[model samples]
Target: MVLNERYNYKLSYSTRNSLIMIDTILKNAGKLLVRLSAGAMMLTHGIPKISRLFGEGPVRFHDPFGLGPEISLALAIIAEVICTALIMVGFKTRLATIPLILTMLTAAFYAHADDPFGTKEKPLLFIVVFIAIAIMGPGKYSVDGLKKKKRSLF
Candidate 1:
């Protein structure tokens, strides 16, 4: 009767709301996943370089910019480690992405320039992800979003 119809309507409405919430969560999660995975992976490469930079030995590294090994390693760490961390936390995301994008460009064009396409593929993928993030921006589930919310409250 009328009671059953009301119950069905309420259930459908609740279900619709649930679906909307899940969609939102998934959307944000996608951004988070990209940030985390890219950052973590870059860290694997950066961390060892960091150790190498500080390790006791002649800094033997590719001097793509003619900047010595130390400088090159420093730049790589800044991009791969620091900027990646910033991107992961969604703090100054766009600015952070700049360094990462640059690093990938360097890797693809210079470091792996003489190598085959397969050697350059990894950096290319990072470049695409960084570019996508730069375009889309950090989602609502981010530190940037929190800052925005706070600003709006003022």
Candidate 2:
């Protein structure tokens, strides 16, 4: 009887551990999905602005915070392009989300302050996703994960 109980206990413990590992993998995959989708979508917005930044005529961008149109556009490009790329690869992901959150905040609030809810909705959604990423940090399937593994070997 004692040997039988020990075998049952071990089986249950092993099953519990397998479930936990599976849960962790699913969570990491979800995080990777969020990062990739957000980064790719934001790139669509940022890429168009690139032409406007260097094109012939005046800058003609939203000048929130009195920073001048060109400067505001430049900052937007940095956040939407560079920071977003970092987040997508899960490299310095939390740090990357900061600029994106700020940019989306500025867009949803100051830039579109007077606009209807429809205009504000997209930026607000981006803000939420970025904030979530910031809180969660990069997950297992990322550049950050590679760095962590390398360190663990040492």
Candidate 3:
């Protein structure tokens, strides 16, 4: 009977440990998935703006903040491309999300304000995702996580 109880305790302990591992995996995987998808989608918009910035003659674009067309375009590109790349790699994710969140806000409110809901819907969704990422943080599968682990060991 003692042997049976010992085995049962070991089994329960191992099960509990496994469940914790699974939970960690789920959280990390969820972060990675969202980060990658959001970054890639934003890039679709960003890359074109990049080309337009460099390849065009006169910088023709909207100036939502009254920052002038070229300045606004530069800001958009920075947020969409540089920041998104940082978020995807899980490097300084919360900081990276700041620019992205700002960009989405500008798009949804100032730029698309005069347009229909269809125009505003996309940026609004992006804003929500970016906000979530900012709050939850990059999980154990990220560069930030690796840095944290290294720090803990030291």
Residue 120's C-alpha lDDT in candidate 2? Answer: 100
Q: Per-residue error at 47 for model 1, in Å?
A: 0.9
List model 3 lDDT by residue over 1-154, tens digit each: 1226646534466677887899989988999999999999999999899888888499998898788898999999999999999999999999999999998998889888899999999999999999999999999888999999999998
Q: Go through the candidates in order and give each one's C-alpha lDDT.
A: 0.87, 0.92, 0.91
Model 2: residue 44 alpha-carbon error in angstroms: 0.9
Off by over 4 Å in 3: 1-11
lDDT of 1 by residue, 82-129 (tens): 898888899999889998898889999998889999999999999999
Q: Which stretches of candidate 2 lie above 4 Å from their native place?
A: 1-11
Ranking under lDDT, best-scoring first? 2, 3, 1
TM-score of 3: 0.90
- Judge candidate 2 at residue 27 and give its lDDT: 97
Which lDDT tens digits does candidate 2 get at residues 1-154?
Answer: 1226647534466677887899999999999999999999999998898999999999998888799999999999999999999999999999999889999999999989999999999999999999999998889999998899899999
Error of 3 at 72 (Å): 0.7
Whichever of 1 and 2 has more TM-score, that candidate is: 2
User: Which should have the higher TM-score, number 1 or number 3?
Assistant: 3
The estimated TM-scores of all candidates read 0.84, 0.90, 0.90
